[model samples]
Target: MKLAPLHAAKAAIESMSGDQVLHTVDGHAFIPMDDVWVVATPSGPASFNFNNLPGASPELRQQIKDVCRALLVSAAPSRASQALTAYRVLIRFLAEEMPGRAVEMISLRDVLRYGASLKAKELYKLRRLKEHLLLWVDLGIGGLDDDLLIRLPDLETKHHEVGAAVRTLDPETGPLTDMEYENLLSAIRNAFTEGKLTTSNYTLLMLAITLGARPLQLAMLKCGDFTVSARQDNSKIFILQVTRIKQGKGIRPRTIFRPRELAPALGTLIQQQCDEAREWAVAHDVAPEVAPIFLSDRSSINMGDIGLRGHHSGKSMAEKLRRLLKDLAVTSHRTGRKLHLFQSRIRRTLGTRAAAEGHSASVIADLLDHSWIDSSLIYVETRPAMMERIDKALALQLAPVAQAFAGTLVMRQDTDRGRIIHTATRSQLESVGTCGKHDYCRLAAPLACYTCTFFNPWLDAPHESLLDSLLQEREILANTADLRIAAVNDLTILAVADLVRKCGEMVGRATK
Candidate 1:
């Protein structure tokens, strides 16, 4: 019999069941015969091949491959991919450090040596490598034993401490400063005004800033996810239902309340997306209901097209943000800074701002979708202005307690200032050291006294010279181009000016 066409044969084979067997001679048409048994060459099953590690023995490489195959079978696709990459990195590192040695024979000392070769920032990778190795041992894919666990360094501790320190000092990775944030918002508004930013990009960026949602969550949002309703008070409320991709146990969706100010832009953007999505569905011959709200520009017009995936990937969304930021010239306000325009940083900026606004850690954790409260603590710790406010509140709270021990705290009538009362303690006056004039101390006498914490001013005090001196000193500092000195002088000037203003008010009242 003549052979069937290649496409036809493939179709027939695909339609056949695993139990049913068909034989073909000379790779032609399949013929069925029940009387005699005939064997046919089976096409090999598709398999993944790990790259050969340099300087690794054949046996060790085979063992690594076996473990990775086990991972591919047992783990989820994303996890399996990560495991494969992590294993390859570990094997490559091991191949260089301990050439020709079996993984089972890898000692704690060898692991430590491998860790030492990696930079501090790569500790998380090392930790992942350890996790994979442990998984391989548990699954019995490799000769590694439980003993290998003993040798692995405490990556969790090292990573935590180092990460905290880095987050505290590393300006690039942390949240945007107030000035930088304002600049970014201004740039975004300018971009919208100029029609340079796409509706999808603008909506996503706004959502990121306001809701602090991850890029993936934003990308995966469907048309049905957005909802607008009228409140009982006749005001419109815009609510976005975000699907938690990295959820555990139950599918708990998050609700993001769009601010009233952003509602108009959000509503307009969403309407545009719905129109685009419907058009895309019609173009691609797909159901309009199934189309994503945040469709990618690269999406194809047909379902069979290789580029038919409509939604943007998390990575592509981040890339779009980076390009937009670059175009806007959104550089950091801090020195030696670059435009850090990733989703996580934007989210972090929101979280940090919330923390600064006196939101509790638990509330922030809930907002950020953190599984633990500790994750939110980093934002709280990094906000110094918030800490200063907290410190001031605490000092006020402790004031009465301190006053109880310091005898009767009262305002004393001053000889120089007539009938003025000041909040002061005898202890404060006795313990606090006297001020000395340095090159820094430009303010003279009564004006300088207002800047001192120990020098409590009375409203009745003679402040004519103090006010004039403070104004003169401020003028002198303002005239100079030394910003640092001027800043310090400005603070002192404001404090003294406030005291002088209060004295004048008291004098007016006394006359009245």
Candidate 2:
């Protein structure tokens, strides 16, 4: 039997009855021809021919085809796609570089030499080739020799090392900065306000920034996915329910809230989408129901002469976003690199902000719908703003204790309530009477004591002068102190001034 040319094999597969072909696990039909396999696609049958492989024998080629068939049947769609590409890459290498050499006879050294010949960008394909070969051996489809498996060089470690080095050396690529984010928001708002942006583009950009949903998630959203609730106060709450697409199996949907201020805009966009969907349905003589929110203007699928409209794909959404960014002239400040606003980056930015705002790891994971909390760590790691916020929070919490230790305030235990402490400095303790509710007061000492009716100021406590000093100090600190710590200083100043006022009253009463 003679092997047919690649085109002839493809044509033969195309002519075969679909019922006669074997179906992959994904339910796609495929037909085997000589030493090649052809899988049916929407466009037509795609051929995977190994007859021209440099070192592969007829038997080895059949084994490769068997593995391809197994993958198509068992692997997920993304993995199946990768396997197909890997098969083609391996065949190309064998046919062009190692002509006439049997694949099974090729040593580990030969594989290494082949890898060395590939450029950096093509290095990932070599990894995929090794992965497919290993899978084939594991599945016992190829009956590959043990020596071939043992000699297969471990390229993963080297690949990772090189990748890390490249990332470190070229660290210019990163998330948007504060100013850049503000500028982007401004540009988007201005464009939307000016009617320059379409309803679809405006809604997509706003949702990307506010909800941080994945492109596929946004594309998959339907008009019914959003629920708006009205409160008694007349304010409305918008909730968007997103279906997770990337997770392989059995993942629950996630719900996110839209900012209250965006409610009006979101409502308008939803109304517009529904109106368009209804118009399309009416034009096509189809009953209108809840349909895709982001409908594609161009139909990719044929429905006779009627032409069926479907939801926009992730690729299409990304392209639309890119065009918007290009029109806005958004660019990175650090490297002056042209900015490509990706959905993933928007998600990262939101995750980082959530972490900075003191949300827990579990909360971040839940918000992002990550399977593991560790995955959320990537967004929060080494962010200086988050660290600073944490530090400031810690400092504020400890401010009272620090003041007490420095002799600026005092703490006295209330035996009646073991946890309650009466706060007053040595001077205040001598001048003012002890607070009656000190046993119940949970507030920081001195300040709360000053405003209490139990407070009695000493006649010679120099109350007027103390009030002047406190007012001056408060004004100075208010002007110079960091905003984060200024509130703590303000509280102390208010407490001391109240104590001084009470003392002045007592002094005046003594003189009378």
Candidate 3:
């Protein structure tokens, strides 16, 4: 049969409806098996068309569609898409060896020849083909021969796993170096403080940095998922119930989730974003209870399609995030270039940092939400990049946190009364240093003063107390929140640590 032309096919396309599948895109629908389906995937709605397989006979396409449509009911949403890829390869093989033959006509010899036709790089993809063939045969007699299904070669994929392990050690593609990680956190804080990063985007980056979660998991976040509890002192402990992805066959995000306690700083940022997202979602007629927190702002979106929208682009959150980081233009110390900020890199960094802190594989696996221990092995095996103290691993740079001892060291605790400046921190207003510049300034108060050349710090100020507080916060956040959050104050900690030493020497010398 001569297939329909593209222009004719465009106009002749038919639509179908299923509880899950929205429609079809078949130009030549020989059987009613739905050759092409536009289905709602976990991330968003997607189209999977089998019309590319024109070489596939009507019987073979029917068998393949039967297997895939059945899978749509029980398998993960990605399975249908993968089946398209695997079957397309089979269709390509058929065009060469057996033109337009039905499913049951293919034998063991034919299947072996198909396998041999694949290139080395394409071998892993064939694994899915063999599985698809078996599933096809199980559907009916109009499939590959039973002998081929029984005697199919099992792929030895240990080499693939080992290759993945080696890639995890790469600085550019895998785990970041200790200094590079530090710079990343510093840049995040700096960008946020400067208002270059928005509140929602800040929360997005914080989640990615801390949890190392995939983009789909992040996209699945809902407003109500963020819950709050209290500690003994009534400090609010925020818990984010993150959705799980890539769990296994047939598992959906809503079926499984893991709760993680967020750091106070991040909790504050996400709380602001939650209020904004929830307000927007509710005003748009979506049920408040089920409103998504990670929403997009595209004008073309219908009120009904807002559910599970990825980001501003109506595309994957991965692309949205990559664009956000690229827009922020976070520069790396290693290459002096804009950091790409890949999610996989964040995950590897998170894993390696956990391993460097003496956490076992079980702990690393739990932190990364890995389904198997083998996936977490690379972190344990390759931790040489992270040798810094746990608290300093991914330190966020302070706004003024960037420098140490830039201010004048005065001999006496007494200062020119008018020169002294007061700032509030931890709910208390205290005088830290005197400002040398009297003109109006918009920089963050005490932090900016520490590195200002015109500022003068007194010997009797509570520098030790501030240093202690910084260290304590960093230590707590590292364990409860994440290494990145704990280390956010690292530069400021170093700055304070330097000041304390300088003050001590100045005081001791004056007394002598």
- Which numbered prediction scores highest in lDDT against the true structure? 3
Candidate 2 per-residue lDDT, tens place, 1-512, comes to: 01122233334434665446655433455554445665532222345665644556667666666555555555433444455566556655655675655565444555566678787767765676786566655555443555766765444513322222112322233455443454466567556645788877887788778767776566656656666787899877665667664453212122332222346767767667767877776786655654667777753333111112355655566666667766865544334454556666666666765765567778877777666787676555534231112122242343332221111122233222222223333365333234443355454444444433333334344434444544555455556864333343333343344444444455577789
- Output the worst ten-in-a-row residue range by lDDT, candidate 3: 22-31
Off by over 4 Å in 3: 1-34, 97-106, 119-121, 153-159, 162-168, 299-315, 385-512
**Tens-digit lDDT track of model 3 for 258-304:** 99988998888778877877777668765554666667665223323
Give the top-scoring candidate (TM-score): 3
Task: State each model's CA lDDT, in order.
Answer: 0.51, 0.52, 0.62
Model 1 per-residue lDDT tens digits across residues 1-512: 01123234344544665445443321211222122222211111112344445554556665655444333323322443455566666656776665665454445555566777877777666676676666555544444545565444343424425335325634677677554565576567546645788767787677677778776566656666666777799876666666664443212223332222337667767767777888888898877765678887753222122122476655566676667666766655345345667767777777877776778888887787766787788776666341112122232333222211111111334222322222223243212112222223333543334444335454444333444544555456657733333334333343444444445556687799
Per-residue lDDT value at 279 in model 1: 88
Ranking by lDDT: 3, 2, 1
Clashing pairs in 2: 25-73, 54-94, 54-100, 55-101, 55-102, 55-103, 423-445, 423-446
Comparing candidate 1 with candidate 3, which one achieves the higher lDDT?
3
Candidate 1 lDDT score at position 471:
50
Could you estimate the TM-score for every candidate? 0.57, 0.57, 0.69
lDDT of 1: 0.51
